[model samples]
Target: MRLNRGLPAVASSLLLALPLALAGCTSFGEGSEEPAAASATPTEVEAAPIEWSDCDAQIQPLIEGQPGSERDLLFECGRTEVPISYDEPAGATLPLFLVRATPAGQTERIGSLVVNPGGPGGSGADAAIGLALTLPQDVLGRFDIVGFDPRGVGLSTPVDCIPAELKDRVIASEPRPTTAEQLDDVFALSREMADGCAEEYGDALGTFNTVDTARDMEQLRKSLGDEQLTYLGYSYGTTLGSTYAELFPDRVRAMVLDAAVDPDTDVVADAEASAAGFEAGFDAFAENCKGLIAGCPLGDDPRRFLEELLAQAGGAPVPSSEEGETRQATPGVVLTAVQAALYDTASWPQLAQGLRAARDGDAKALFSLADELTGRLEDNSYSNLLDANLAVNCADTDEVVEETEVRRLVAEWSQAYPLFGAGSAAGLFTCSVWDAERTPVPERDAAGSAPILVVGNQGDPVTPLPGAVDMAEDLESGVLLTWQGQGHTAYPKTDCITAAVNAYLIDLVAPQDGLTCPA
Candidate 1:
């Protein structure tokens, strides 16, 4: 079955949000918007019960015509009426769309395994179906796999303020703007985007932060009839899971936070860490490429080829030869594709092929990869993934780097992190120019909660290895599980990681905190 791949929890302004940014045959309700608002504090409001129904109308279309999809599993959909603003429990409420996928021929069912794919924008509803299709029967048989699009995401009450054309322009812009003129262009674009979101959402925009989403999880748990939450959270979903663990420590039965985001780091710190991680990932790719028989597509030095490609792409448009494709190759698109490929090692060979094609002046391969990363559809229309991405990301943090600081960081990081530095530093301005109050990532600890497993990948590009280490340290009852693997996440991918997680989630047997598995 085709999967909803992992994406970063945090995306840069120029980078765009690429959470599970795969080209799709299934048009899963991409573009739609609902007005949102809230603040103060979460109150004790009874969760509206869920009435489960067939999900075929929405989900079947997604997996039907796809090459490998076998439509054999069962999926049910439901809606939970959650207060849009928990601060006002009796006030306006929005429907939180949910999908529950039953394991193949279950033996004895345990509680639900709430899986979150982790974009502040990632669709949990999509994740539920993906996990159902991919998860092993051992873990699957014991639990009902549940996924829901949190508020401000697909098929739910969304925080969609961004115009499609504007998003296209942002993705096509240069990621690393150095010159004063280029920086000016970025600033102007940022202002226009920020003003538009503000005009659309107003103060209600602030309500789209992480804390509120955590509260939504509480309601989801109650509605699922699970006495405690059993969650499998990834990437930005880790941020949400960690936050939930803190808010309702006692309510967490078993939680596996894979590819975690350190709650303590502010925006700049997170970006810097990502920059360092991407740089390392590129180096690894380069090493692997060099060891190949042909010895790398971009020649012995891939970095130099990228530099040249960026320069040429900026001056004369590098055309995409993808059939019926009209988009030109820009620096933003090139880097976005490269960044996306680095998320998983399986895509490195594809990345090499794209670069080789680019070397031959055909940008078709690059465009294909970039389109998948940005959720740019076959017709050039986009998904609401990026919309909710910017909305929740900005709302989650108050740290906004000023132009001067950004320029300084850009100059310094450009040298510090050779490939991704300058662009990432420029991206620091995304939240700065954003028009919303912040609910900064809180200091998280699953204090009284059951031992929550915090899994980390040594070569994770987006969340990075350090974030997971920090996550384990911060949580009072957190246990660290390290995979010396090279990918975005380690979970059913390897037998070692899978067995440990299955044992922990099913039997409540916590692995030793410092257990490290070889890649």
Candidate 2:
């Protein structure tokens, strides 16, 4: 239930399956160069144009039907048409959805604090609604939060590369091929998927990448008339913040990049690191399960329980109690389900209860959990923004290994992490075949006046600790903040982290060079 108590049985490499789309591309310069400063002029921030008639006619009815806190949250609907290519400046137009939420007081407006939740597919509008509830009160009061569905994501001009059946088949694919033939099929499938994207989407896919999104951010800044940008990016969003800082270094007033990803690493590197991180997380989960009987399903030997579970899942899935549905509860599905629950500790108890039920031959609980894991839930327990994620990743990754290479890697990783390596390797199948143009890595130089904060989680099963440490060393003004805990992304969860990040954002106070917090 509590997967982060030790480490995930699977490698965290699947995180890279989404690819590291956060932050600026190499175009920003190398690590040694000083980043340029933002314009200093204080200009009145302009409100985005809202079509009140359009809102009443089209958007209001949709909002009225929604029930709960989202209903109470103020809604401003608007659209911005950006060029398909930033370089072209006046190319084909794409409409982007913009959602704005003003803070309680008008006097404390800190301009628009652009927040991205980082699924590359996560709807910014949805994130804004949830963020309004979870954000630290002090931070919320000071900034007017703006969440936008990035191009080719959410309300934006989204991608429809895979048909519904193909998408379903792809998500439910076996963790790894059992034979050489299967691997070949996967390779062909991956290539086909990527090719489909390119063929279906064409040049429009190129604009969805992070570099272009950063340009979109700049456009947003221009539209708002703000000389500087403030941002809070989570998970993959950290990459976006980093990208923004890289492109418009002078314009970044303050940024909180939670669950940081190293800009220097490609998807391949990210895949390897993520795999290892999840293994570490599974270990933590096992350790926690050992002592807590009521909260954990595994009786006495946690490792043994996991081993048996994996074996059972891999062999043949059992029927679920819920609606008598027959589903393949493969180790991959189980691990993916468990991993999703680990994101927030709030879901731990539910997982524990489900596992307890699973131990009783009621696979329904696990199946339900898996459903939530895959974004079948209405609350968006999973990151449903795969279209944009694919666009960014397909563009960023210059090369994807063939099926043979993937199989070899899987075998190697399996040797390294016996329980979850295959699943991690399998997740990469999607990225390897994503369609788009391959470009050289951009030059990213972080040297500057203000210190850029890099947060790391010690037992993170996604973005490992080494990444933060390495990025800190790479950046000229990088400061490392280590959260000696488990899971991905630390800020807003820990008081110490929140205090540090809040201080940095509010007063431009960077924490000490190497700051670590213990659980």
At residue 114, what lDDT does model 2 achieve?
Answer: 79
TM accuracy, model 2? 0.82
lDDT values for all models:
0.77, 0.60
lDDT value, residue 196 of candidate 2: 72
List model 2 lDDT by residue over 354-440, tens digit each.
665655566666666665444343332233344456666666556666666778777787777665566566557766666555432
Instruction: Give each model a TM-score.
Output: 0.91, 0.82
Candidate 2 deviant stretches above 4 angstroms: 1-73, 176-178, 293-295, 323-328, 377-384, 439-441, 447-449
Off by over 4 Å in 1: 1-41, 57-61, 64-71
Which pairs clash in model 1?
A: 37-204, 118-237
Scored by Cα lDDT, where does model 2 land? Answer: 0.60
How large an RMSD does model 1 have? 5.3
RMSD of each: 5.3, 8.4
